[model samples]
Target: MTSRPAAPVPATAPAVPAAGRLAAGEQPVLPLSGELELRPWRLDDADAGALLAAGQDPDISHWNLFTVGSRAEARDRIARMHRRRTAGTGAVWAVAPRGGAAIGLAALNDVDPADGSAEVAYWVLPAARGGGIAVLAARRLGRWALDELGLRRLTLRHSTANPASCRVAEKAGYTYEGSLRDALAHADGRHDVHLHTLVAG
Candidate 1:
């Protein structure tokens, strides 16, 4: 698959806060658009209930951590994300449409500052499927990671059965690195997971 050049980082916005984590309750470090306006997750969004609700949609939550357990567990996880953000661990962004409710979430799940590498994860509402939103979101997040965070590499993983997800990663410029058999065991059984990676030029 062909890769699009990473978007140029804007000079106006500071990459990350001095402490490492993006500043809480401020505008996105790199404003993004298309399909939806991807922005940083706000602690205030917990009250909106979409984060937890995303877990309830089977099509959206299948193979996702939020749906691994139960609805209450998903709610707790969202709360935990907020706490972690304040603790300077990482960020979970809400994929919200302008003047609409949040339909999904994308996050910088892991980060290694010394190596400048991070893993990106995201999900979309069942209602929002088939819109090319996931690919657009992933690309926007990649731009932020490369230009804003100055990351050297970013990776995304999905189950082999999830062809839509694979397409999203490919469209966003991630190379299909390979698959890991029995990588994740669902409640039913283990399944293979496809791993993809993108390195900054």
Candidate 2:
């Protein structure tokens, strides 16, 4: 008697590799419109000055929860930024004119290369505000993160009270997903956050 045919084995879904998408390397200077660029933070006084200024600016301090009381602290923060890149956990860039001191910052925080996702964040100095620098920098960084780095999703979250950031997120082509209740804590108190996202095409 012929033996009964064996049942077919069910195919299993392919597993995602545990390797990280980002590896330690020389971070490239990403170009923005006409002389503006995003470069890695340097351990120089000028870059530290930018961080100090941001920490001191009332709006930036309030929104970003950043406070650098001294130049040394700012330098230490810059060093940490580099270390984050090396660790594949974050990528921070100084937004500036070619060969000039940074006037703003753009960052990919909480980067999970295995998951292909990261959060986008930025802040422009008072002098740089009102010129659409934040929008430009955000757009350029999003492109780099999605197109160049192969991240599947980029999230941008801001306190619900920050209309300017909402505008920036919109202009940068991020789609608003919804609000997150008590998602972020600020100097004032806990705040609800608006979540926006950009996905790779």
Candidate 3:
């Protein structure tokens, strides 16, 4: 019999590693200072109220484009936050004084273990504004994400119209990269966004 040529094997992409660091254990409580900490959100009335307050705040709603109509909705959102942590897609924390109610939020959204990256977001209540809480919470959370979680890069994007947020990003050790034209849509309209980044050393 005549010899036949062998067929070539098809190529395949390498498999991505799962986000074991984020999903392997319970979310941790990160302390910002003696009085403040970034802890996991609870499904209780007080935490729900914090979400409600953030939704009702004109600045937070306008910038973050988030709103909860009622306590039930807020609780649902809180539950989703917990679910995301377990799913390794996100990690969110409530910024609170020790043994007190949440007064703000800090989050690492769009967590991608394969890419080793995430985006940072945060907002503080009106009463907590102007006290550098946002900056502190952001810095603390960024440290944990980079050092503990082993993420290589973190990005922060904010509307150019919001200078306060820009300040927060700067003070939190993020380097200003550049602006993206019409990158974000706010309540007013589509706006340019400033991109800031922090890379693990």
Candidate 4:
């Protein structure tokens, strides 16, 4: 993929704990309009079903390449998210609306605290697609990463074929930078990507 230039960052991970862990008191909470909240993935009763649904979605599986095949596998994947957070590389969150199941995910990947930059991503379940949750959730996470984590910038890129994701990136305030021609190799083949970014003042 076309890598975004890094912005300078402190050489330490933010002391923010995420949801579901016992140290959740330090978890950062991001509230969105219409009552959606982004929190750390919990090892709660719903974790199995939630992650299974995500893994089973044809769209999610197609895009992610590595999808969970069982509840155990789902748990393991989430554990890796937690480990990444501890290592100060990345963080993932479950998108929870008021009185609803965690219906989507918002995350920062390839985080570089030393560079003060990260890549933001989000996805909504098929059943949840029409609600515009993706844009709101992604915007919330980007803001949190910039504000709470003291990041200098965030990059968001999507395959050129995914127009819906491009819309989400634009609406989330990431300005289109340019295209990365055949930057990523997916299950189907290499794909071009549209790169977008939002820089902190």
The lowest-lDDT stretch of 10 consecutive residues in candidate 3 is 12-21
Model 2: worst 10 consecutive residues (lDDT sum): 13-22
TM-score of each: 0.77, 0.89, 0.89, 0.84
Clashes of 3: 0
Residue by residue across 1-201, what tens digits does model 2's lDDT show? 999999999996333223344544689899999899999889884444888888899999999998887888988888898888877888899998999899999999998866778999999999989989999999999999888887889999999999999999999999999999999998999999999999988
Error of 1 at 42 (Å): 3.8
**For candidate 1, which ten residues in a row score worst on lDDT?**
13-22
Model 3, range 1-201, lDDT digits (tens) per residue? 988888878876333336776977789989887799999988884444888888889999999998987898998898899899888999899999988899999999999988888999999999989989999999999999888888889999999999999999999999999999999989999999999999888
Clash tally, candidates in order: 0, 0, 0, 2
- C-alpha lDDT (0 to 100) for residue 39 of candidate 2: 93
Question: Every model's Cα RMSD, please?
Answer: 9.5, 3.9, 5.9, 8.4
> Candidate 2, which segments miss by more than 4 Å at Cα?
1-21, 45-48
The candidate that wins on lDDT is 3
Compare candidates 1 and 2 on TM-score and give the better one: 2
| Candidate 4 runs further than 4 Å off | 1-25, 45-48
lDDT agreement with native, every candidate: 0.72, 0.88, 0.90, 0.79
In model 2, pairs of residues that clash are none
Off by over 4 Å in 1: 1-30, 67-76
For model 1, how big is the CA root-mean-square deviation? Answer: 9.5
lDDT score of model 4?
0.79
